[model samples]
Structures are given as structure tokens and as C-alpha cells.
Target: MTSLERVSISIEKRLLTRLEKLIKSSRYTNRSEFIRDMIRSKLVEQDWANERREVIGTITLIYDHHRRELSEKLTDIQHDHHDEVLASTHVHIAHDRCAEMIMVKGRVDRVRALADRLHREKGVLHAELSMSATGDSLR
Candidate 1:
């Protein structure tokens, strides 16, 4: 087990009240777990802010597969970044629509660029990049 430490800080009453409400609404049994998650979230954000840092992310895209040449274009884009893309899955949402989720692991800039390219393709109805980390520093 990892060693544990205790610390305390002061906050404004209003902010503290808001934190309490958030904890209760989220059904957290206590404040420590909530604070730990808040810290982890900020750390992940910091990791992605450094462009050279290794990161992981998923790019989700929804598009109309019936659009002329759209599927081929998307496939070409993925192949262009094949080294960085870990895996991908495609689902047929309907006769005309499809959804794709591409898992990527690479430097922040490369991942972001790949996501942008996928999102900018003409037939993409929606795209979202969910950023995460390699988990080397969470401890």
C-alpha cells in the first residue's frame, strides 16, 4: 500500500458550501474521495497541456455513410496516422448513418491533429475528443 499523508487548506464559506453540495449530489460518502478525483482530473489536464507529453484519447465521430466518398476519406485519414492510432471500431447506426470510435495514443499535438482532421471531414455530423493520460504520474 502507498503511504498516506494528511493536509488541510482554507476556503471561502460559499465555495465550501458549493463543494459540500457537489459531494452530496454526487453521492460521495466523504470529501477525500471527491478531492482526490478533482486533483486527478486537473493533473490529466496538465499532462495534455504539454504538447510533447504522451497521452491517450478517443475520437468519436458520427457521420452519414451515404455521403459520397466520405467513408473512404475517413479511412485514408486513419491510415495516414496508423502509427499513432491504437485501434478503431465502426458501427452502422442506420442505413445512412455510421459511428466510429478511434482510440489513439501519442504526443498531444499529434493526437489533437488527428482528431481535427477526422472532425473536419465533410460528412462528419459530430466529433468529440476525450483526452486522458498514460497514468505514469497518477501516484
Candidate 2:
């Protein structure tokens, strides 16, 4: 097991009260766990901001499947970046619309590029990229 270190810091009374309110609403059991998670989230954000950092993310897309050549173009784009494309799944949102979630891992720039390309496609109704880290540094 890893050793634990207890540290202390001071904050203004008003900020502490606000922190308590956030902790209660988020349902965190203790201040230490909540603070640790907040720190980790900030670290993940830092990693994403570094374009050279290797990261993992999911590109989710909603589109009209019947649009001419749209599905083929999307598939071809993924194939072009096959090394970064980990896996993908497609499901029907309705008779005419489909959703795709593509898991990717690579340099931050490449992942962002893939998402951007997918997002700008003609038939795509919406596209969002959920950023994440590989967890090598978080622990």
C-alpha cells in the first residue's frame, strides 16, 4: 500500500463555507477525498492543454445515417487514423438518426483533429469529444 501524508492549509472563512456547501451537494464523504479529486481533475485538464501529451478520449457523434456518403466518409476518416482509433460502436437513435462513439488514444493534437473532422461532417447533427487521460500520471 502507498504511504499517506497529511497536510494542512488555510483558507478564508467565506471560501471554506462555500467549499462545505459544494462538498455536501456533491455527496463526498470527506474533505480529503473531494480535494484529491479536484486536484486530479485539474491535472487532467493540464494534460489535455498540452498538444504533445498522449491522451485518450471519446468522440460521440449523432447524424442522419441516410445522408449520401456520410457514413463512408466517417469510416474512411477513422481508417486514416487507424492507429489512434481504439474502438467504435454505432447505434440507431431513431429510424433516421444514428449515434456513434469512437474511442481514441494518441497525441492530443491528433485526437482533437479527429474529433474536429468528425464534428464538421455534413450530416452530423452533433459531435462532442470527451477528454481523458491514460492515468499513468494520476496515481
Candidate 3:
């Protein structure tokens, strides 16, 4: 187990009150734990910012199922990045619309490229890439 270090920080009164309110609304019991998680979240963002870092994320897409060739085109893009794609799930959101959630783990550039390719397709109504990490760095 890693040892914990005791430290002190100074902040302006206004910032401290804002921090306390944020912690309470977020339901965190203590400042230390909340601060730790905030730091870890920043680290995950840093990992993604470095293009060569191996990261993990999900690409969520909402589209019209009836659109010509859209499904096939998205499939082709995933196939092209097969090494990054861990898995994908598709479901019918409505009679005419569908949603896809694809989990991918790879270099930041390749993953972003995959999201861009899927988003640029003619029929995709919405596309979002939720960036994440593999947990090694977090630990």
C-alpha cells in the first residue's frame, strides 16, 4: 500500500467557500477525498491531451436507422480501427432511430480520429466521445 502524505494548502476565502459548496452538493464526506478525485480527473485529461498516451473512451452515436449506407459506413470505420475497438453495442432507440456505444482503447490520436470519422458521416444525428483512462495511471 502507498503511504499517505499530510500537507497544507492556502486558498482565498471565496474559493474555499465555493469548494465547500461544491463538495457538499457533490455528496462527498470529506475535502481530501474530493480533492484527490479532482486531481485524478485532471490527470486523465492530461493523459488524453498527450497524443501518444494509451487511453480508453466511449464513442456514443445517435442516428437514423433508415439512412442509406450509414450503418455500413460506421462499421467500416470501426473495422479500420479494429485494434482500438474493444466492443460496440447497438440498440433501437425508436422505430426510425438507433444508438451505438462503442468502447475503445488505444492512442489518443487514433481514438479521436475514429470519433471524427463516425461523426462526419451523413446521417449521424449526434456523436460524443467520452474520454477516459485504463486506470494504471490513476493508481
Please name the candidate that would achieve the greatest lDDT relative to the true structure: 3
Residue 24 accuracy (lDDT) in model 2: 97
Q: Please, what is the TM-score per model?
A: 0.95, 0.94, 0.96
Model 2 residue 23 CA deviation (Å) reads: 1.5
lDDT of 2 at 115: 93
| Model 1 lDDT tens row, 20-76 | 999999999989999999999999999999999999989999999889999899999
List, residue by residue over 1-139, the lDDT tens digit for candidate 3: 9999999999999999999999999999999999999999999999999999999999999999999989999999999999999999999999999999999999999999999999999999999999999998898
The candidate 3 region of ten consecutive residues with least summed lDDT is: 130-139
What's the C-alpha lDDT at position 112 in model 1?
A: 93
Q: Which consecutive 10 residues in model 2 have the weakest lDDT in total?
A: 130-139
Model 3, position 80, has a per-residue lDDT of: 99
Worst 10 residues of 1 by lDDT: 130-139
Using alpha carbons, what is the TM-score of model 3? 0.96
Ranking by TM-score: 3, 1, 2
lDDT-better candidate, 1 vs 3: 3
**TM-score attained by model 1:** 0.95
TM-score of 2: 0.94
Given candidate 1, what's the lDDT at residue 64?
91
